[model samples]
Target chain A: MKGIIYGLVFFVSLFCSSFAVAIASKPIVVASTTQIADFARQVAGDRLIVKCVLAPGADPHTYQPTPDDVQMVLESDICLENGLHLEGKNWMSTLATDAGKPIITTTDGIKPLAISSEGEMVADPHAWFSPKNVAVYVNNIVKGFSQLDPDGKQNYEARATLFLQQLRVLDSWVRQQINRIPTQRRILVTTHDAFNYFCTEFKLNANNNFLSIAPVGWSTGAEVGGGMTPERRRKVVQSIKESGAPALFVETTINPKQIREIAKETGVKIGGELYSDSMGPEGSAGETYIGMMRENVLLMVNALK
Target chain B: MRFLLVVTIWVVIVGGLWGYIADRDTRRQQITAATPMDLSVEGRFVIEVTPTFSTEKDPFALTTSDSSVPPLTVKLNGMYIDTHTQEVLRGQTLRYEDVSGVLSGHNEIYVSASPPLSENTLEHGVRVKLYEDSTLVVDQTVWADQGALVSGTISFNHSADEEGSHDH
Candidate 1:
């Protein structure tokens, strides 16, 4: 009996010590969205452990933080978020503040496209749609991570350099792919305003003033400048009818019913689902950021061209 | 005795996991560091860029403060050699001095530029010519599918001294 008691105490202490060691060895970075988490992972590599508050295909505009997310934030050294109110009601910022963790806004230096909502213009938060904007995100993450772990600065920079080059390549490739669509047929109609950056980058939705045609506002949430409205829906349908948009696309994170209805009303086919607010789930082509963009472009070209 | 055995088993499992993770991390870092950029210089060379389409700032391209940067990027042996602010018109040859980092024996020039997406229906290309002093050492045209960015590599051989002299 005495031996068993001593051994049990020893084992418990050893286990706790090992757990502490593991936690201390690497710092944790909690990201608000899967895309930001993916970018952090690409730059940090194995130096930092990156965790996403929102799971794959989860809508950032409507994401509610769970108790687990709070716990994760509590343990994380830093938090990253796509600001401009991408997080509905600033949930990520609230969590980070409550947990006393520094929150880095990844979209720090991007020139956000403004969208009008109810006579007021709001900065669009879906900057990742343009690979150029994502480069800004990468740079911000590198700076944030380097501040946290100065020793790993060179490693982070090297990884970021490579990733930036890849982004340039992806940008070039996407331009090439978008060229396949006839100039007039380059119209893009999606479920929401999340594609304004993408359409503007690729020169789509010419009839809609070179922006995206969508029934929903920038955010699918009930934010001030968000959610679907009857006026917006009517405009989308009219724009599609006038532009002769080849097809309409639904987002994986949003309900397809709205887009389907619009497509039916406009007499156009659903091009395909796009990974907008979030990326696709694991084992899917849209798993990584690059993968998501590539698949979206391929689907657009195939449907429109 | 049972508790002692359980503790021993846990130790082995935890130790193995740590070892595996450490090894994996080291391997990843090594792989990242293995690819080093070749910055060794051979000599001065001139590169001419002639675009088949109008050059404009790609809204999707990586932003640079220099507004005069032409739509095209010409890299010599992985280094951006064209930094001139001059506008490269369609079929107009714009010359730049690629003054350093020309590797002897075999050299490569990478050219990438976005053709206007509006002209996606027409296939476009850019002709790149490399001249060492007046002799054209390498001439290659990089073409792109209708609506794609023009990206291709131009390779050539040059036999010169360490001082970049062609002594007969």
Candidate 2:
């Protein structure tokens, strides 16, 4: 019995070392949210060992990284996060700081939408929701990875090129679908500020006062940002009336009640819920970023146009 | 027993729906190489280009360095022509005279074409010229490749050093 146990231990030790060698050889990419992770993996290819901090079905807006998540970041050489305040401010930033890894905010050079009324204000970071915006994200990610692993630059660029083409095609297809809807009906209303990029890309006027993939309540315990103030609700109601927006939109991450009440009061029908914060679990259509955007656009066209 | 647990995770990560995703990681790149766009992070374009070089000077043409200097004037006939067919407009043609590339500042040089662009196009163009130098660079000819990337050297006749002297 003692001899058999020793043999088992020896074989396990040998297997563990071999596995460690294989894992260490690949570059590590730790992403803040599931969407960014999906985008990174699309570009990083086999050369990367991608790990998403937000679990499947986890809402990034409300995500608090666990010790395991911190460890994942600490072990990774690179981190990719959706900036624009999409990860609920302090929570995501703390993880980025603690991990002490070089982090790239995918929305870095793109012009951002400010939630402030002036129309030209703070950077809206949920740019990945728009396929065209994702094109920009793709470039930034490729540049960051190349900086980290010059040896895999060719692989990254090649992957980016292919993915970006799909984005361009997706953008064109979205435009075609949106064209089905008349200009007056192009108003898009969603739960958070998540769709700014989508609105900009597809040329729809998106009203997301909550204005973030991560919902904010004007106060704590509010549906979003505690922002369900009488004034904010009025603004949405007024915007819908003023824009003659025959329709309103919802997001997957947010509860539909806030939107339901507004839709009922405003006398507008709910178009459809969109995939905003996170993609679908696994088998659903919105599993991949591209797939998510495609599903959202298709739903939008069906609802509005 | 521990080995089996880890093996199952590896199986989950490398198999099932994730397997489809993992397979995508190995898919070959299929994007066609695009010519880089004429624009770069920091690139220069004569926003409001000069007209062209010419000996004919306006009546009020001020004489500076050398009066005999062909009264350098640029007579540019810039019209936003049909992108598909390059045809000048009779009324919509814009005319700028004896402009130097140096005095060129950033401005939207608009040409009132017969048909105003009320909608968007994948390709939008701005044509420019150095009037006094008779130097012209056509921009509408540019196109975005598969990745919407534009490429090629944007030649401006008047580099900071090439100011007074024509390429000649």
Candidate 3:
């Protein structure tokens, strides 16, 4: 009886150790944002372990990389970042480079929407706002994973194809939902110019050149054309008054003081807190990329329609 | 006796795990490669795609930078039949003659098109009319919700006897 008990214990320990080794052997993929992390997980599935540098609702524009983040990148096999300056001061790239880890820019191969900031045309880093651009992100991530783990290429590609189809469905759903709002009343006002891609894709603010209207420029950080400007504030106020926008909105990542003050002065109600730079926390409606877009569209339609 | 029992238990556990993993791998492979439809199944079929409303480019459509990829895609039995890159007017019935892979017993025609985003409040549909040598075989209208893509599969059974009769 004693020998049997010992043998059973040894067998269980061996199985447990083998399982742990299998899990540890899988490559780790560290992403810059929660949304990127979600996309990586969707493609990589259980083949690769995915980690996010920025927490949910954490602003990537002004996110300061911590020592823990550096250690995470150093231990990671690969790093993914939304290039075109979405990460403030190129923090994600800098971390990956310093750690000597291969980095994949998810937004690669996208025909970026350019924004005129401080007399210079800068590529808007909010390409994920449009699902079409997100297809590019998923494709790039698939390529990155396949290159790293050649054996998992077929697995990654299959998952990416399914995710791409889901994105197509999401795009069509968003359009149908946005169609609920009348064209003339489709004025989208938010904290920053984060929704420029969204507005361009959905034809919001058609009267205002089919672009987003906000008090802040593209980035929330103090880049050349970023941060809040007096002229930009005046323009936002003027546009809201001229267009008779039904409501204004604040972002979860940025401080709502500026937009709130504008709303108070202009007598426009704050429609809702939108998920911009980051997604909602775990268990929230805006937790996933599709969920965030759906919630944002629903909020906008309800307020404007 | 104790040694034999322990070895038997170990073999059973390990063998069960191996069987589970092998089964899982086989299932995954099956999902990865879709069952290829028989394109050799021949029929003189003409599929007509008639939109209830004008088809426009969906702003949020998942398309590559490739200019030639059409906004409207129609597939017959999992094979590409025709694609329209530009706006397909309401009255214009885009027709296709060479539709392959259609099974003789049961056939499927898939239609996916972007309805005008501006007309999202109103439900829209695409009328898929299939004619077997001028004899209408299948007439089905696939509808989408107010603002969604008009995408659905129209299935019908085709028999050799129904070639000239409008039975199916």
lDDT ranking of the models: 3, 1, 2
lDDT, model 1? 0.80
Q: Taking the tens digit of each residue's C-alpha lDDT, what string does model 1 give over A52-153?
A: 999988888878899999999999999999999899899999999999999999999889999986789999999999888998898789889888999998
Error of 3 at B133 (Å): 6.1
Highest DockQ: give the candidate number.
Answer: 3
Question: Using DockQ as the measure, what is the rank order of every candidate, best first?
Answer: 3, 1, 2
lDDT of 2 by residue, B69-106 (tens): 22211222232221212333322223444332232222
| DockQ of predicted model 1 | 0.12
Query: For all the predictions, what are the DockQ values?
Result: 0.12, 0.03, 0.24
For model 3, residues B1-168, the per-residue Cα lDDT tens digits are: 888888888888889999999999999999989886553546577889898889887654433334544668998877888778889998689988866666757667889988775676678899998876677878888998646678899877766555643333
Q: What is the TM-score of chain A, computed separately for every candidate?
A: 0.88, 0.81, 0.92
**Which run of 10 residues does model 1 chain B get worst, by summed lDDT?**
B60-69
The TM-score between candidate 1 and the true structure equals 0.67
Clashing pairs in 1: A176-B148
